[model samples]
Target: MVQFRKDNILDRLVIVNDSSSEVEGEGNRDDHNVGTCIYCPGNEHLTKPAVLVLVQKEGIVRRLSDTEDNRIDDWCVRVVPSSNPLVSISANGTYSNKPFYSEPAYGYHYLLVASREHCRPSYIPAEQWSNVLVALQDRVKWLYMQKGVSYVAVYMDYDASSGWHPNLNIVTFPYMPPLIEQEVESINRYINEAGLCPICNIVSMEDKSPRHLVSIENFTALCPWAPTYPYEFWIVPKRHGIQLLRMTQKEIDELATMLRVMLGGLYTALGDVRFSMIVHASSEKSRKQLHWHIEVHPRLVDKHGLEDGFGVHFLSVSPEYAASKLSVASRRELAKLVGIT
Candidate 1:
């Protein structure tokens, strides 16, 4: 049985799956070969039937799904179940007690294919990115309405060497992640003591700071005061919104533009570096205290013992320097992409 096991004394949790050891050792050998790229268009049979497919014809976009016998061929974006899921919906809910406390790892894992083209540039076009976000919002809203779902985790893992197509992972969890829980607690504490949202205040304070990168219509991108990785930055909504579902159409477009410009800048500045993009938000119960944002962490350096074991991060480039380097490139890229200049 695949189960979530709580650390003996700490708040940490681990997914224990006894059967996955051998398969996990095989590594991502197939990920680097485009000839067998399952995510590429016309290879729908290589993956599970798509749950959501977005197709554009004559300037009109339609949302669709795939059945076992049919698959949409001209889809701009697609979402399907992960072939190797971390958790399963069919998990039996059995609980163990005391020092060996455990619960079934019950949830859904999905992969959102970002585009139709294979071997494309690091950053997709802004319009395509918007479609990706729209599909994501659709999936996340549906996931939240399901029974026993406490959180929906959205993130992307990209490495040039992996030869994998561009996609984002959507994972549903029955319980809140420890880091998110801590963030919610901290945000609530700050609100009670200061009578204002900490993120909103950060946006206001950093608007003109050296750490500021760029600001599009409804979003602003900036380097955090303390970063866990080199050249790490965050894209935050200017207003105090707690969920992506609350975003307006205009806000979504702006966010897509922000993503395109920032990612293009990262690629231009550092080439095809490995990175992770994570979306952090509050669950329904804690929405009032938390704000939603996206964080981009470039894995330029390896984590050492102090970082992995002691939770202490060492950064070579300061936020100010990183922002200064990224701002000029991103602005130029934005101008070329959307005529923002």
Candidate 2:
């Protein structure tokens, strides 16, 4: 955790406690509860019931089959909503708050109970990942065809390092969020004035709403410019999108493929790093903009002082060199990873 005592700003302090310990958090872990995490390879029956299942049979040409419609004894990937939530996010349908966060008595906050073995998304069998891709698209369509739906997103947070609290947070709010244009503009402004966000040159050069640059076919790595850590790295979607739940099965499949390769790349470059994945989307589908993207943060050091004291980060390596070293689809890295070889 980024040590809260020294340099963290008030808003950025996310007090994530150890879930496996005997210590209990103050708030209720049941109200928004969807079900058990069930991400580990063994406990399949303990999870929230699967609302949707996309399976892959051995003989299938292009693995795309819905098992949710029929009760299937055999299944590859399953989807279930969260039983309890830490940070509230919406997915699949929009709900209003009679108090706030409350919507039409029906909100969608499901989870994608990935396949059996406990590997990260990058390591999950390509076939299972493909099933998830198609299942997510089906979920989005299921919500869109229904009433009172506005937006959707496919999210997952891998926490084996955090005690295997593994699950995806698929959210659909009552409304859409603002596009990353504001983010881009603000980053651009910071770069223009102070030469900050130096890595943003990548964005400035192409300047497209949804850029199509891969991390490169061979290199699947990158370093962040305004990283909040010593050797913090970022895995961002090259396209400009906000709500990724709207993506098609093919798109989701591609996302899964790239993500798998990237994870493998990380392992190849870094010895053993703990990381997290986050997905954000544009509000109400944002036809005007694309807000689809993801971020991967490898926890290298216990961010004790720098981030806790000032918002400024003490990056230990150059982005270019880190990228080259990591040897992923992208070329970027920041601090502590090693010198920009």
Candidate 3:
């Protein structure tokens, strides 16, 4: 007899048919089938009803509470369930009581389309940028209250090309990922030894070091001292906050600008380099000492077998050098766009 089993490691993971090239190149933007742009305005019915949407009217960004009948002109930002979700919404199994080998992958996954029209997040119209950030924060707060969801991860994928449209995704996990747990543990140890937050200390040090790239009123973007990959940069809030949902409107606006500037800089420095951006925050329990930040990883180099097998990474670009190059590029591009001297 065959038995049904629930496993996290080997089951419930998302599978993508990557028939095309893995490394995204400038010319590869046209590789995606144009007819299958399901996220486009006219293709609203192709996916699930939007959970959250933000619209602009009279120069004010507002949320569309009613999503019964979504239209193309109804919203500027849309958040709907993913067409290909890695985890299911159904609570199939409870927390495992056993020492643990198998358990159901119970979670929530969502797709956040920043603009109704196909466009990159970095180059979105200045008016709608804040609305996009607001949509993400609203959805994150709602997902946390969901059953079996202990952690939430929000990320965006950008291709430095014209044909492809970037999208942001939010996924909730039943348990904290091992990487996050390890980071928390390290933070705890550092706090015990130094009587302060390591991230805050790093921020202060970077502010005074060459690794600093851009420093805004509320946020700062810097190149980490020891990045796992080349040109890996992080945009962190100066305020000591953990839950991203707790940020005020002004703070959110600042973050949106910072993201736009940093990403726009990358676009200027490296013509059409695809990159991944992720948001990290502490859970309710760990909110006291943890800080929330956004990490941007540019796909400059591929990881070799040794890096994967031994859990080590060899970066070709140093953090200081990368920071200098990115800084100049970001400043030049932003000044031209915003008319800043």
- lDDT: which candidate is best? 1
Which window of ten consecutive residues has the lowest lDDT sum in model 3? 12-21
Model 3 vs. true fold: TM: 0.85
In model 1, the Cα lDDT at residue 305 comes to 100
Candidate 3 per-residue lDDT over residues 1-341, each given as its tens digit: 11113345434323222222253421122333455666666666665787776777787777874345754446778787776565666535543433344455567878888766665656775456678888888888888887777889788777655555556878787666656766788887899999888888888878879889878777888999999878889998886763578888888777777777887788777766878887777764345345778889888788899797787889878999999899887776557656672
Kindly list the per-residue Cα lDDT of model 1 for residues 7-62, writing each as its tens digit.
88884789876656545522132452355877877789888899999998887778
By TM-score, highest first, what's the ranking? Answer: 1, 3, 2
- Ranking 2 against 3 by TM-score, winner: 3
Candidate 1, poorest ten consecutive residues by summed lDDT: 24-33
Residues 1-341 of candidate 2 have per-residue lDDT tens digits of: 10111113222222232332343421122222255434443444545556775555674523233332434436566665555432233222343332333223234667666655445555565455566667766777676655544656455544344333334666554444233445545555766688645333444443321222234321222455455544445544444332365565556655665565556566657754666665544444344333244666766766656677664566676555555555533223211122232
TM-scores for the candidates: 0.94, 0.60, 0.85
Candidate 2 Cα outliers beyond 4 Å, as residue runs: 1-45, 59-73, 86-107, 141-153, 162-166, 174-221, 229-251, 304-310, 328-341
Q: Number of the top candidate by TM-score? A: 1
All candidates in order of lDDT, best leading: 1, 3, 2
